[model samples]
Target: MTRFNALLLALLAVAVPLSLLAGRVWIDPFDPQLPNAAVIFIELRLPRAVLALVLGAGLGTAGAAMQGYLRNPLADPGLFGIAPGAALGAVLSFWTGWAASGWALPLFALIGAGGAMALLGLIAGRGGGVLLFTLAGMMIASLAGALMSLAISLSPTPFAMSEIVTWLMGALADRGWAEVWIAAPLTALGLAVLGLAGRSLDALSLGDLAARSLGVDPRRLQALMIAGIGLTVGASVAVAGIIGFVGLMVPHFVRPHTDGRPSALIVPSALAGALLLLVADCLCRVLPLQGELRLGIALSLLGAPFFLALLLRLKRELA
Candidate 1:
């Protein structure tokens, strides 16, 4: 399984770069303008593709770690509430004119995300129980989402509303290398932490009691895992907004190939996630609309129905 995951990672590390270079003008059979082609490739397509790869890899790794720690295949990065928390932080920055000033929004968004995770951790660990910790994280997410909506409603500026809505939809359009540098290191760190914890997660699959008997401390590892996932998702969301379902969907794509093992699922999920987001971003470029579609909307428009069908199939299998 590990070998297979390593293979998938190697494949994607190559594919993402080639896909970043692919485009309409360069790939077209009869295109003639060579100098303009360089400008478009460097200024437009490359950045979008890089953003997609980073965002996808970050969310995918976070999702894999969350599912393993929670022992629920359906779990995602949103489980920790960082998405809405970051959105709200961004909204606050826009309303206060901070986002207009510079990169303050991303900075504030990270703070908001970290704060929300900290609150969840404190509440859940009040008595040192697993179920309560999971329950607390869910509650924090729901509450943060509601608060984000409330903040939007209460803001007086109409322009603020439009800006907030556009951001929440998620887009890689017009983003530059700065967004890449902002997100990539955090994603890399988060992935490294999860990779080191993979053996711990494998022990966790045997249930917490079984893990404790084997000398793995489930509680400590869970705390670390949740914090690591929070950082990855927070950093990604701070830059890209609430891109949904990648976390939910990527594990589903990787699990069948990995035979449902936590250790095997992490890296493959990252690779599959990078591939999925790059494809989605490319579709965003070629869509027949005047304005580009948000990656979140594109993903939801496509993934929602696929997920519904998947759910129905699962029910039938269970029966």
Candidate 2:
């Protein structure tokens, strides 16, 4: 796992720079012939690359924390209403033309995510039992999805609906530094709060009684975990537009190689997530498609097979 973390560190250094050097721009790195090429590189490509890395790392880290806490590999912020709630916000923005200013979209998305989590907590009440939390999240996710569908269907213009749908497919296209700045603070704060979550989760692997004997309060950890996931994942969704599977898949990709130690999976999982999204974004840059490929679609195309293989392996293990 340490070696894996070291490898990821080296790769992270190269990932952003290489991604900046890519995109639809055909300028040679050595020879700057295109007018405003440098500006384009700085103002456009640079931010999108940074957004990819930041958003990917956030999702991966949140996913690892969630799986550790819940003891469920499939546990994710999306499973709980965060991603769908953010999507609802983005959809509302498109429907009402609020995103014409570009800044309102992410802000709305963040608000939506926060609202969903708050609503869940209010309904489920104190003590934060796992089943109650899970159920509340499902309700919120359902509500958010329904609202999003209604927004799309009721949009005044067909073009607006198409715009919403395209954005929902997700991309890092033409993102700016302002978006990165907006998402970074919340994501970083959440990451810091959950920095020790892996170790806590290691303790939580024991039964609740055992964990309590060891000074681990499940309720406190649950609250911290939820806050961390909400902030990190909500910020990622606000910026990245519902890029799925990275959270659900990254820990699995890194876990087996790391001696199957749950706590040790966190850092490597995040780095692997960064690598996955960076490569996906770079591939989207070169694909010969109208308006380029959507980042979420590109990821799904890659990850669906992996998911199916995982299912088959689980089936065999059961057999």
Candidate 3:
């Protein structure tokens, strides 16, 4: 592991325990008199923390891979339409009252992600350029977003509308080992797939013709990106609603510490993403609000400013 990776790992070690102990009702790990400490730690906090780690790593790695693949510093995993597609699925679950079922929501979300992935591949076609691929993804995202809005507008009941809106805001409250089980293996497999495409991403960083000359197969790389991103981003939305920006912001935070190669950036970005999400979730738990803040809203509040700063920086550089 790189020093950056080691640093993130160390931070995570401290943060995980802190997250478990710090919540609306604080627990004293050392206090033998603390009631239900084990139950709180095991039944509630542990799974939520694990889910944060898994999903954050997935988003972070996806963001790094996306920026490298498109050669655009501003690129995000959501740009591929997979997230919106997944969100649409989750919204549909609410609209149809299936969200009350244990597995229906996630299953619908995964199916939506798969549909988006298939559509992206189909529309981009074999040998499509990066620009075409990106545009196709954007189109799908727009479509999915529209569909979700329509679903909300036509929701059969006020309760369904309320549920849909709240879920779209995103949070980790009440999640359990079941959610962790659903997301962990998928994210791990997605990470492995992205890692396999690392060398190709490095080559593509040099531009399309140059990468082709270097024997990087665009079709294969594209497939890997779609599959990897689909699984990671899909599983995340399936389990945790629509937590955003980890993928977009994480790579930028970690990139300066790395050698600036896409291959070298992935693992460190994953670690940093995990750390960022874990800490953010803890903050959400501890904040003295009417209720815990939504994880998606908190990140968007942080990321929108970060994104604006990047735009300003880019503008200055271009000028």
Candidate 4:
């Protein structure tokens, strides 16, 4: 695990510089003639890359933890509905023309996440099993998605509707230090929460009854999962607008290299996710098109095929 983590760290070190240099107007770092190169690196590309690492790490960690808690390979952080809840909040901000305020959008989104978390707790209730918790999450996700759609349809102006739609597609474009500040601390705290739950998740792999016999507290573990995933996914959505697939896809990439323990998988998944998102964002910037590709779209394009392949593999195994 140490070697694998070290390898990932080494790869991330290489990828970060490439991400900084790759864009429509590529920077020749060695050349002294380039104008405003420092500004571009510091102001434009740096924050975007940092935000990718932060959000990707959060998503990846959350994914590993979720899959472990559910004991299902297909589980994702977004399955908990936190991301959709945050998106609904952001959409509401746009709907009401409050997004123009610097902090209103993220603040609204966080409140929405809190509401979803509260609802999830209420619906799941104490002693609710994993199945019930999952169902409650699905319910919240459905309700949030419906609400977001309603907001878009009832938008006061076409411009507002357009803004909401575009934001939903997701991007790191035009993001700055403010986004980094908003997401980083929340993501870091989330990662810590998930780390503390690692042992419980490992016990959970032995089945709920077995986990209980082994001194695992189901309610405590559930709370940790909810809080960890809520902070990580909510913060990501608050900053990046609904970037998907990172949580769903990242764990699979790293699981093979680990000992198949959730605790073993989390850190490696985080590093790999950071590398993947950074490279993908760089690709979005460098692609020759009228406009840079949206980060969410690019990941979806990659993730859809990957998901299909995974399903086919599972079918063969089942067969």
Candidates in order have lDDT scores of 0.79, 0.81, 0.94, 0.92
Ranking by TM-score: 3, 4, 2, 1
Residue 73, model 4, lDDT: 89
Q: lDDT tens digits, residues 15-128, model 4?
A: 999999999878998996899899899999999999999999998999999999999988988888899999999999999899999999999999888889888888988994
Best by lDDT: 3
What stretches of model 2 exceed 4 Å from their correct place? none
Model 2: what TM-score? 0.94
Cα lDDT for residue 177, model 4?
98
**Clash-forming residue pairs, model 4:** none
Q: Across residues 74-153, which tens digit of lDDT does each residue of candidate 3 receive? A: 99999999999999999998889999999999999999999999999999999858999999999999999999999999
Question: lDDT tens string, model 2, 129-235?
Answer: 66787888898999999999999889999999999988898888878998899878888888776776666788777766666788877677777776788888889
Candidate 3, residue 85: CA error in Å?
A: 0.4
TM-score of 4: 0.99
Q: What is the lDDT, from 0 to 100, of the residue 267 in candidate 3?
A: 96
For candidate 1, the per-residue lDDT at 288 reads 74
Say which prediction, candidate 2 or candidate 4, comes out ahead on TM-score: 4
lDDT score of model 3? 0.94
